[model samples]
Target: MKKLESLPVEELLDQLEVLVDQRDDGKDFLLHSIISIETALLRVIKSDPESDYALSIVKIESDLKEHLVKYGTYLKTEYRKDEISAKSTLKQALRYDQTIPLAHYRLGFIAYKQQAYKSALFHFQHAVEYQRLKPQHKMSLSNQQSYHALLYLSNSALYLAAEAQQQSQKISIHNDVEQTKIDQLTLSPLYKLIDANSSYLAQHAFQITDSEGQRGASWEEYEELIDDATKDALILDMTGREIWVRYGGSAVKLTILNAELLRKLMLNSSETVPLAKTDLSDLFSVQSGDIKIERYVKSISRLREKLRNLKLPLDVIGMVAKPLNGQDTSYYYRSTEILFMLIEYAEGGQ
Candidate 1:
């Protein structure tokens, strides 16, 4: 992936031109090519910081701060918040520099705070898009913000399911070679987030009407859509030495400890199981202490990084922190909405 960003300037531009030309060719091809072009462009800009393209990106970033200040002023000055002006300024920032991920995220947050879920979803999606296309070698402020964008994007989708008007503009995630690529490249991560968050939403009182006009309580409609999008499942093999996550035509392997954590949650599938530091210490045979907790957390983080590299969902190991008595805290691993299977059982049943 890093190499993709390191191509020569002429080559990167040629590739980008080809991709831009195919922008309207089809969504699948467009997304695939766009990602490639973004990777190249990010590399090109890094290699030549003084380039016109790089300066344009920087200028857009500077303008984004100006717009944000204006947005803040609008919130403070108007008795009734001038959301329209704030949004207009942000959109204008995009017109000058569409690659500005921060602008998109700020716009998304504004819409989200205002309870405009559909608008929030659109901006967050673009934030995700820009973040995904950026070079991943180094961490930028925008990169850190993308994590929050993912969270907001998923929540926005859930809320949008409740909007009657949103039903009319259903996400066109149908089947075909191109559509499949589009779904894989663009929609899979969103579905993963929704799947991870579903259990949390399930605990609350809510109802959603899907694009199909089918109504269900507590994110059922969104969950069903996520299920449909997920054609594969994470499965435990008979040997118990590894975990296998299937996605489209590929699979990712996991370490035994990681596999067990997923298996424990998947078997329960609905409960948020408490996992104390002591529990982790016992499970991994590590000495109980802050060190053990740190190691545990690092392991989980690495697992997420691996899944992300595989283009699989980060929901593979979903856990939320809950404070225990005193200063101690326990992590609760939730089964949430992930679909899982035992490879041995699947084989035996077949």
Candidate 2:
């Protein structure tokens, strides 16, 4: 096949039309090919936003979205029979449009079924967030999806907290450390989860029920149960490579090195001490030298930029300057009282 970028606009439109016809006729068509064509057309529009083809491409994209959603819903209903295909189809639907709550809910359900709680939590959170933004009249099935997503979000958090507690207990036993301290660290994730759940409950009146047809606790009652556990802090799951912000439960994606640096900063933040640039360089195994300090400072700068781009508070990572032996200035990094938790999964959990 010719490269998508090399194809003329007319050829791209022709291919899209053919794929739409095949999809509508119940004939086989590669979803990837359709996606490629759409991406190419989008790139063209991005380069020339005022082009006449933009309107046509927009209409074609609408048709593509409709078809993808219908096909994805069909596959989701059969997910129990062929999970791989269902997941791929739903994921492709998301690739085309990430705002689809139904697709996110289905993916979250699949992750929950496979006991991948972290993954489930991520998708369920998105499902709930997007579903709330959808119009009331358009939410025939999505309202139910939002409800189930909230339930599963809490369930996923519970499972993850239990797992973290187990891991902490094992570590305490092996290392003969203080159980209270370990428990405090391990249970911090629960605090974030509870805060998120409580915030949602406070905003939306969801009539959650038990599997046995029993009425579940109201938001007020649920708040009482977790009153002692609620705290305002970021939750960083190092093993899961995910970070949950306070209140909104938005997940922040960080690069691996940045995440490790954040973990180190959070660990030291308990003592309210700033980590010097030299210490950060040592943590990353950078050689002790002027160049090492420069590289580490740049890394910190990049991390702050990432946080800013994600609309997080820059004070999450604070920078301090001090005199080096009253001659030159040195920089140090400190984090707010953010909580870091490790989430270990079995191989191939996803």
Every candidate's lDDT: 0.48, 0.54
Candidate 1 lDDT score at position 250: 55
RMSD of each: 22.6, 21.8
Off by over 4 Å in 2: 30-32, 66-98, 136-141, 174-176, 181-350
- Tens-digit lDDT track of model 1 for 3-103: 76667656766665565334322221243344445444555676785776664444323423433332221322313445565566567656656765666
What would you estimate as the lDDT of candidate 1? 0.48
TM-scores of the models, in the given order? 0.28, 0.44
lDDT of 2 by residue, 267-328 (tens): 55432356666555433321112235555676677667665654444356765555444322
Evaluated with TM-score, which candidate comes out highest?
Answer: 2
Total colliding residue pairs, candidate 2: 0
